[model samples]
Structures are given as structure tokens and as C-alpha cells.
Target chain A: MDGVMNPTTNIISFDLTTTSLRDVNHYLHHQVSPGNHIDIHHPNGAHNLAVGLQEAIAVDIHGHTGYYAAGMNQLASVTIHGNAGAGVAENMMSGRVHVKGFASVSAGASAQGGLLVIDGDAGLRCGISLKGGDIVVGGSVGSFSAFMAQAGHMVICGDAGDALGDSLYEAVLYVRGNIKSLGADAQIEPMTEDDQAIVANLLEQAGFSHNPNDFQRVASARQLYHWNADAKQDY
Target chain B: MCGIVGLLIKNPALRDSLGALTVPMLIGMAERGPDSAGLAVFTQPIAESDRKYSLYSGTTVVDWGQLIQALHQQLGGTAQIHTQGNHGILTANLSPAVVKPWIHEHYPAVHILSTGRTIDLYKDEGQPAAVAERYGFSQLKGTHVVAHTRMATESAVTPAHAHPFTAGEDFCLVHNGSLSNPHSIRRMLEPRGIHFDTDNDTEAACRYLEWRMQEGDDLKSALQKGFEELDGFFTFLMGTQDTLALVRDAFACKPAIVAETDDYVAIASEFRSLAHLPDIDHATLYEPAPEEMYVWTVS
Candidate 1:
């Protein structure tokens, strides 16, 4: 709505009700000026919307999206005004992706960078196989979340389903609510003051009104990283 | 991977737009499965004595007029036939029990897709949008609909192998995952005199439920039994005369989303299929739990 004579701030709009997903992605991939603000209307749960974005622009999608929305995002900020399907921000790199509504399974699976924020609940496997990325969920997440998470930080303000983190790696998991169960190699660890501060900052940035001090940290025990002849009895 | 979609309109006002609303949902799932697509729409039932059977001929085109005339003469009942593309829907006042056996005895080439009082099924091998267009789905009138797009994992790519497998009278099912023990299940059912039309695993699952339902189990209990008896990754959308049901396996490997509004209850393999639904933004949306079955019946 703000396409004035600023030259750098151009506004392009794509109405998915009349256009196809291919056309919409093509325009976003090849036909946008740098630093431009793009508006997507009537997304209507279409999958793979605004994926592989490599610009420093801002996109506002005004409706629900299908699977892998904003996937492989790089150096761009994408916002969804409605719910998101599975793999909302899979493999996101830099910048931020925000979902104002709920998200389906594997919200941010195997992301190397970038920030993913879900203002509502995220379904099963919320952040599986996270190479590196910051994930913040305002509400709860489903079972088997953060499975085999490699690095980065994941925060959930609400409850978590069964097996919150299974075979977790170095990623720091912070949950403020109850956990149904912890997965193998995942255990709750004492939170330090620095960890509390980090959680507080992430919550504030994600617009979640919760006390970060109440969060618990879960990390891998690291016993399975290497074989130990002495530990064979425990197996 | 396959895509499944089912919509049950609770509000009568939306009945006329059932086809219009369902086309976008089916087309939205083009990426999940593009091999073949099919749909089953349930309109209002006519007289209790009348039966509706949707037939599919494997060949691209066929002259169904002679067949319909022969079927009417054989059953000695009045029949009305409507042909669309290679699919034909015949509504006759004859019982499916009588019509099915007679057709099979005389015409071994014709495939009876589904027989119900209110259901009409149409499917083909192609893009979902094209398949829907061929059936004129955007203009059909119905209160509930279930559709599928198949990727040909368990069977060959043929119109006969398309989804929405009919289980029994006024019943059909669509699947998104494969069964690991279909051959064994088929073996078990063969001795009991159960018949299978296609080699697809989904047909096995559908026939299993049909057997269970024949033993007097409701749709919910039949699916509950399915959870224990059948083994494999599966998300099933089943439709009966007045009910629409969905069930997912315990592993939840297959994705499913359910959205409910005052007007309708919609289920799809993903949310994108439900996005274009009316007032969906305000509708309560969530994924069905593992090993859980959801059934909605019309009042």
C-alpha cells in the first residue's frame, strides 16, 4: 500500500485466486526489485508459496499456506497472516519468517540459519534435524519435536507433546510448559542465567508474553555419539 | 505419495456449491500426486427403491447406450443414464445386488466403479485439474464429496486403479499411503470368499473394511478394527450414504489436516487444499491424532 516515489520501496502484488503458483513463484524468484515489499493475496492454503527467496525484501501473504511455505528462505522476511501447512520454513537461511497462525508438521526441519516464529501451535516434529536456526513458538508443539536437532536454539512457550526431543544433538531446547515425554538421549538440564536471558530475548522478539525464566533446557546426553566398549552392558 | 480430500457440508445452503468448492481443493493437491485423479460426489438420494451406479470403461470411449438398454431389459427396471467423458453414471430402480451380478455375467469388460443411492464416482489417469474438468465437477450438485490423486505406487497407472475404491453400497474410500501386508491380507480374504477387482493395496484395505462392516460394524468400529488388523502407513478418507470418515495410522507418517466450520467439515492431506474453503480462516483447524478416527454424519 505504500508504493510512493521512493524508488527503492516498490510494491508488487500477486493474487493467487486469479494466478497460478508457478506464476507467483516465478515473479518472486526473478521479477522483484531489491528491498521491495511484495503483497500476496488469497493464498488460500496453496503449498510451496514464496519458497527459495534470496532477497532482502519483505513479503506479506494474506491467507493460509500449504506445505513448505517460505522454504529455503534466504535474506528475506516472509509473514503469513494465516495458518501454515507442513514444513513451514524448512531449510531457511537468513532473515526471518513469521506465521501468525498454527503450523503443521516439521515446521522448520533441517534449517541451517534464519529465524522462524509461530504465533500458534506447531504440529508434530516442530523442528526436526535442525542444522542451525532459531525457532520460537508462542504455543505448544506436537510429538517428536527437535528430533536429531544438530545446532541452534528452539523455544516453546506452551506445552509439548510426547517425545519432545528424540536423539537430540547440540541444539538447545527451551520449553516453558510441561513435556509429555523426553526422547532417547534427551534430558533436561539446569538452565543458567545466560540461557534465561537468551530465551527472554527470543520470546520478546517473537512477541510472546511469557516469562522466559520459567523455561527448561533439554539437550543431548552425548552418550551415543561414539561407541564405548565399557558402555555395552548398558545397551 | 498421494493426495486425499473429503468435504461434508452440514449447512444446506452450501449444497449447490459443493462441486465449485471441491474443485479448487482437489486441484491444490496437484503436487502430491499427479498420476491419476478421481472424485465421488454424494447428492440427495432419490426414492428408496432407486439405486445409482457409476461405471468406468478402461477404454477411452465406449457406446454405453446399448449396455444401459440391455441392463434395463435384463433387470426389467427403469434406468436413466448420463455419460461424461469415458465415465457413465446409471441410476436405476434395481437393487445393486441384482444389477451387479447381471452386469458381471453379461459384460465382463465394464468396470462398476461404485453403486449407491446417492453417490456418483468419476476418475481417470491425468492431472488433477484436467480430471476434475472432464467430470464437470464444478457443476455437480452434492452435499458431500471425496476425491483422490494417485501417484501409482501399489498398482499400474490405469483408470481402473484410480482411487475412491468402492467398498460396498453407498461406500467408497481413498488412500494416501501403502499397505505393507496386502498380499497376505488378500490371501486371508480370498478363502473367506471376498473378491477384489484391482491389485492396488488400497482396494485390499477397502475390501477389508467392507468385510468388517458387513459383519455389522459401524464405520468408526470398522476403522478401529482396521488399526489393529492392517499394517502399514495409511491415511484413509471414507464416505458412506450419510457419513464422511477419516483415519490415520499410529505412526502418523502420512500428513492430514482437518478444518471445521459451521458450514462444513473438511479433511485433506494438507492445509493448502482447505485454504480456499469458505470462512476457513475462522474455522478451527488441527491435525488428527495418530490411530484416531473422525466421523461426521448428516442429521
Candidate 2:
């Protein structure tokens, strides 16, 4: 009925110790506006914080969060000042999510777009099946990372655990340190000029100072897409 | 999943509010594990030359006065019992070993939560808030406190199934993960005359630590042995007479955080559990690496 609403500059705060998780999520779903800032205190390991948001609002969680915090987001950016539990930012579609401390299992699982950054190490299965988003970890990542990732980019400044990439697809992965093992249909790929540019840009965006040249790229071998009678032994 | 909270106050000035401060921490973790809750408060050692034994009765009603009188007549010593909710702490002028075996023989329905000079343990199958209120957690005065909220993964939801499992005299442990080889370990310990009350895996780990310490191993070495001998994921918070220790499995599948300030050293399964702590903003917070054992002691 009218021109677009002016970008909101209001800051709203929710104290989790006094407010219910349902009320917080309902407020984020209905009251959030573009450019609005939300601060959540005493998150106290509550689950599903700031989930399913599409606005370009910013959420700053002051304490640790439980599973699926900021899961399946669109344009909203979320920052956890403390550690995150399992499935954080799972199936996220767009915008940015940053974890200042460590993350439990499946830190950035199946995100399709935007950047997911962890300042500390991420537990097992990080960035699993990430569709198109970029993930950058300032520290090491646990085993089975980037498993079945279809698209996007991942940069680890520290070591990667066992099976760095398992059955991954078009997504490009770069790690500065050693990988314990590789999953089926995943292998190391030579870094080209374009790969360096992509990793450098992602690292810069994620606020990491790691040099792009130190990273090794990995991708899917593309060998298991179809069944072969002669390759039955491999199966 | 489970929630663990422990606070070891370095400053004696904060001793009086230890229980008040820890009640909120344990209650704050209600969402993590709501099936049951427990707390072990290590109070300042009393001046009296008596032994204190914390006991629990799962039944809704019990005659605590009669039980205490009977215990006094049998053990031939003066006894005083304090009852809170479903638990009681009995102080008697008798050796703990003499009183413990007598309780086990005469009062099989009564569960011995802890027996120590400074620790009083309370636990039951209920919400965290209810359990804390039942045990007067907010009013307890202690030098340190360790608590747990159990979600009932490996054992049935009962008063005896709660955590803060006693490791040895004046030592206890709370665990957050399942043990893969508890049966084998229990078999090994049973032959060594170690008794168990429940089949819960954590009790096995607790008894194992007790056995190791009995064999003259220090707490640090015994926890290191836990990493070598125990399999599966775990993050353990252990409390002794004067120190608190935390250790994680090699894979560290569980989550844990440590925060320390000038007044106290605190550990919790999550940072949220420490948010309400005093001066937490100024506290140094970090996650311990896998297989790394961190200990804090108060003099």
C-alpha cells in the first residue's frame, strides 16, 4: 500500500531467563524488521533460538545455545557469543551465522547459502551436505566434515579430522592442515588460480587471516554417480 | 542428554551463599534433563567428632524419627537426623564403616546417597526445581557444590538413579555420557570386592575411580586412566574434599565449559549454566580439549 518501510534501527532485547523460548521465537517471527537488532541474554542452552527468520535483522545471543539455534534461516544474521550445541544453523539458506566459541556436532549442516563461521573448533559432521553456503573455521574440525556436501565452499585454518569429505559433490573444500582420511568418492583436487581467489574471499569475509596458498582443495571424484557392473567389487 | 553444574568457591566469604548461588544454576539447566535432579553440597567441616551419612527413601512417607532412634540404640551412640523432602542426613558418633554396613543390613529400603564428613548429597526423580526445593538447595551452606539433572538414558527414573555418584570417601562424580564397557568393568571390579547398587554405567565409572584412588593413584592419574581404559563419549565433573576435576573422552562428543574468577571456579555442561554466576562477565571461560584433565583446588 505504501513505499518500503524505512530500515529499522530499533534494538530489542529478550532475557531468556524470564521469557519462554516460545515467546522469543514468536517475537522474532512476527515483530522482526529489516535492520532491527535483537539481543538475547541467558540463553541457557535453550533450543531453536531465532529459527526460520527471513528478514535481514541481526541477532546477538549472549550465552550458549542448545540444538538448532538459527536453523533454516534466510537473510537474518545470528551471532552466538558462546558455544553452540548440535545442529546449529542447520539447513540455513542465506545470511550469516557466526559462533564465537566451540560448536557441538553438525555445526553447519546442510546450509544452502550465506556464510557460517566458527571462531573455535567444530565437532563432527560440520558443514555436512552444505548446498551452496560457505563455512570457515578458525580452528580444527572433527571427523566426517563436509560429508555429502553438494555445493558451496569450506575453509579450515586448522586440521581436519577423519574422513574430511565423504561422497561430496560440487562444493569446494580447502584445509590448511592435515586430513585424517577421505570418504568414498572424495579426493584432493589441485588448487587453481580461481580456487585461491574463492578461498581468499571467503576467509576475508569470515574475518580470518589464514593465507589462501596454504590450503589444499578437495572435491568429489564423481565416480559413484552411476552403477557399473565391472565396479561391483568396489561397492 | 544431561546437565551438570559445579561451583568450587575459592573465597571463604562466599561459602554461606554457595547453595543459594548453585540452586539457580541447577534450575537453569532444567531444559537439558528434566527427568530427575541431584546435588552434593560439600559444607564446611563441622567441629563435632561425628560421621554424617546422607540417606534417601524413595517412598512417599517414612518414620525418620523412629529410624534415627533405632540407629542410636543399635550403634550405641547419640544420633541426630535432619529431614528435607524425601531425604535425610544422619549424624552419629560412630565409625562410618560400622554405620554404613548396619544401614545396608537393617534398612534395605533406605538408599545411602553419600557418607562423608563434609558432603551431604540429595537426589530424587523429579524436575530440577522440585528436587532443589525438596533438598533445601537454596538454604544449604557449603564450600563447594556439584549437581546433575538426569534424563534417564541407561537406567530407570528413580531416586537411586540420579547422579553425583560417590567415588570414594569425600569424593563424587557426575557424568554426561554412556560407557560402552561398563559391564566388563563392573565384572572386573566385582571380583575386587567393589559393590554396586545400580546397573547404571556412571556408577561403574565412579566405583572404578574409587578403586584406583584406593590403589594409591592420584586424581589426575586416575582420570588419565579413564581415558585409556573407558570407551565411548563422556565429560566428567568430579568433586573431592577440596578440589574439582573435569575430564573428557578422546572424542569429546559431549559439551563442557569452565569459568574461573577470583572468587570461584565453576564448570557446567553449557555456558548458560554459568551465566547467572557472580562476576561471570569477568570470568575466564574456555572449553577443555578432548582427553585434557583440568583441576582446581582450594586451600
Candidate 3:
């Protein structure tokens, strides 16, 4: 991509209106160094923008992005100034993806490891099937979020919709606001000092000012871990 | 996957550009739905005594003048028709009870797309962009509009199966997800004298909701019943005379986003369709919650 150089900050700016996404992605995938800072202008809800980045460069997308915007993200720090579409950081390996506006369904779905911070609300099934990822939402999450999550942490600073953490496996959820309901095998347990410390660290990383003591922890009850023939099929 | 787009103009000054603003949104979802496309536009209602029917001739050329003349003769009603290609909107001071069966008998080849005091619909089997250009969607002016582009997962890829499905006056619904029990729903409605237009899944939902309204349930309660009875994954956007309502299934598997400003409210299956909207940068953008009825009416 023929990006213009910002002589002062040494930031490279790629205008999507002129440069194709393939060229930009090719450059990001193959040519970026560890310390590079890139600016993408005019995203306009395009899908698969700047995905599969393996370097530690910083990326700032100026507008909204479509599905899988930062999917499979690596060491790069990517931020969208506007909203994000479904599957924003699906299967991310590492690094950070931050959305300044609300995100659509399945944000950070099945992400192995990374920090996905949404300053606004996230839709249904956020972090569904998560595998060792960390998600911090400044606003509420919709129904069936963190369903069957294996391992990770989700910190919700606001309210959560129905089925906060359903059928969870070793994933801890800290919510500072009310949860409409919990999923099967998920229960609200008494928060401990260790949980408070974890919440504090994640909140600090997400740049929030909420007190960790205000959060409640939701985890699996381990009842569904094995089969029970006497209880019929209903949960 | 299918594409659904709806726009309701609250500002009278912006109503004239409803179709102009929605064309890009329909085209934006071309990848999701490329088989067929259609739209229903709700303009100012005509005289209370008059009703209009959107008629499509479907690849067959018919003399619209002679049809209107014959309608005026047999029905003994002063009927006027406006034509664009094979599609026409016929207006008359006639009840749908008398006119619908008469057209069905005389012109069996014609398809009645919609009927209402203010609604006029057009649909065809083609690419969404081509279909939009073919019907002059850019020139349409209305208070609200509901449109769909089809990928044809549950039914045939015909123009009739394309969305903006209507069952009663001044109301239309477009769907993005398939229903699991459309056949069962059809069986439920057929005994009540409600006719089945096509076997498409969305038509079942359209007729069911309208049937609920016909039974004295308001839009919100009708939708509440719909959530209980309709078993499937659906993001339905509907348009009535003066209102636009949107809802997703309980699971919320499908995607929908709304961008609303003081001037207008726009709904689409994705934000890609809404990026080009006027003042979208400042519009309040949010996703509709699962199983919640979000209804907006023009003042």
C-alpha cells in the first residue's frame, strides 16, 4: 500500500478509499516492524481489515469495521474508533483489540489469549466459547454471552442480559452491575480478595475507574460436568 | 443469509430522499443476497374510501390499460392504474373483498404484491442492484420503507418468494433468517380462511402477525405472540401505515443494527449498509436486543 508518511510521529496512514484492503493487509502481514504505528482511514464497515497481524505494531482504524475486523490478531494492538461488526476478534492469539463504539455479536469469540475492550455495549454471545482470552466491556452484554466458555476472564462494568455465563468451564466473570439471569450450571459465588485483585488489574488495563469490590463473580457450579440419568434431559 | 433494510423518515423534509438513501443500503448487502430483491414504500394515505394494490405481471406483458378498464367495467368502480414495466399499482374505491378475487379469476397470471391505503410494493428476480435500478427505487418518496434481498434457503428463488411479504393492508415484513415451523404455521392459518400466497417461510410470519392484528391485537402484543409461536432464527423488520417495528428471535442469532437521528431511523442487517447514511457519524447506533419489540412511529 502507498501510505503517506506522518513526518512528525513517524506514523503511516493508509486511506482505504484509495488503497485496496488486500494491499494494506499484505503490507501489515509481511512488512511491518515491531515498533511501527499505522493509521487506517475510511474503514467504513469493511470486513477483515488488518486481520492476522503477527507484529507488535499499533493500528488505529479511524471508522467502523465489519465482520472479523481483527480476527486471529497477534502481537499488534488494534483499535477501532467506531463500531465493530460481528466476530470482531474471533480466535485472536494475542495483543489487544479495543472498540470505541458498540460491537456486534460474538466479540472476541473463542479467542485464545488477548485483551478485547469495548468502551460501549457488546451484542449477544460475546466471548462465546472463549479459550483463555480476557474481555472487558464498559457497557452491557446481551443474552447467552460467555456460553460454554472454557478458560478466561470477562469483566462487565455494566449490566448483562439473559444467561450471563452458561455451562462455563473454568471461566470467571466479574460484573459490577446487575445480571438478568445466569445460564445452566452457572452461579454467583461470593467474591474473594483474589477475585478483587484480578478485577482491579483488568479494570486498570481497560482504563476504567470502577471499584473492584463492587463486582460479583459468576462461575460454574460443576453440576453438569457429568451425566445424571434420574434428572431427565432438562437442565 | 438474506438482507433486510428499513428506513422511516421522521422529518418531512427528508422523506423525499427515502429511496435514494436506501438504495446503497440494499446494494451493500449484495453479497448476502443476490437472487431477488423487493421493497414496500408507504406514502401519504389516499382517501379513506380508496385502496391500492401492487400488481406484478412477472415476465409477461399485459395491457394495464385494458385491465384497469375491465376492472372499472365489471367491478363498476373508477379504477386508475400507474405502470412501470410489467408492474402496476391500481387504485380504486373498491374493497379488497370484491377486487382481489375478481383479478384472480380474470388475470390468473398476475401476482398481487401488496394492498393498502398507503403502501405500494415492487419485487423481481434479479440482482439487488439491477432490481433496484429496474424499478426506479431511487425516485420513490415515502414516510417509511421495508425492503429485502433474498438468498432463497427455504423456498424457490421467485419474485413472489422474495420478501416484503404482506398479508393485510399497509403492512409488510422482511426476514433475514429461516423459520423452522413455517409449515405448521401455515396449517394453523389455513383453517381460518387465510390464503397462502407462497410456501416461503417469511410469508408465514407476515400472515401470522397480520392475522394477530386482525384479531384485535396491537403490534406489540402481536409480536409478543409471535415470539412465543414462531420457532426459528429470524430478524424481522416490518412496516405498517405509520410505524416500523423490528425484532430478533430469542437466541438472537441473526444480526441487525439501527442508526437513528432526529431526521430518520435506519435499520439494516449490518452496519455496512448504514455507513453511507446522512449524519450517520452522529446517529445513535445500537443493536436491537433479542426478543424485544422496537417500534417507531411517525409523528
Residue clash pairs of candidate 1: A45-B272
Name the top TM-score candidate: 3
**DockQ of predicted model 1:** 0.56
Interface RMSD, candidates in the order listed: 1.7, 2.0, 0.9
- Supply the TM-score for candidate 2: 0.87
Better of 1 and 3 by DockQ: 3
Off by over 4 Å in 2: A1-20, A31-45, A60-64, A81-83, A100-102, A161-163, A166-170, A177-189, A219-235, B45-50, B60-72
TM-score of 1: 0.90
Shift of residue B172 alpha carbon in model 2, Å: 1.7
Which residue window of length 10 is worst by lDDT in model 2 chain A?
A1-10
- For each candidate, what is the lDDT? 0.88, 0.86, 0.94
Poorly placed runs, candidate 3 (over 4 Å): none
| Residue pairs with backbone atoms closer than 3 Å in model 3 (clashes) | none
lDDT of 1 at B179: 94
Model 3, residue A175: displacement in angstroms? 1.3
Cα lDDT, model 1, residue B96: 81
Best by lDDT: 3
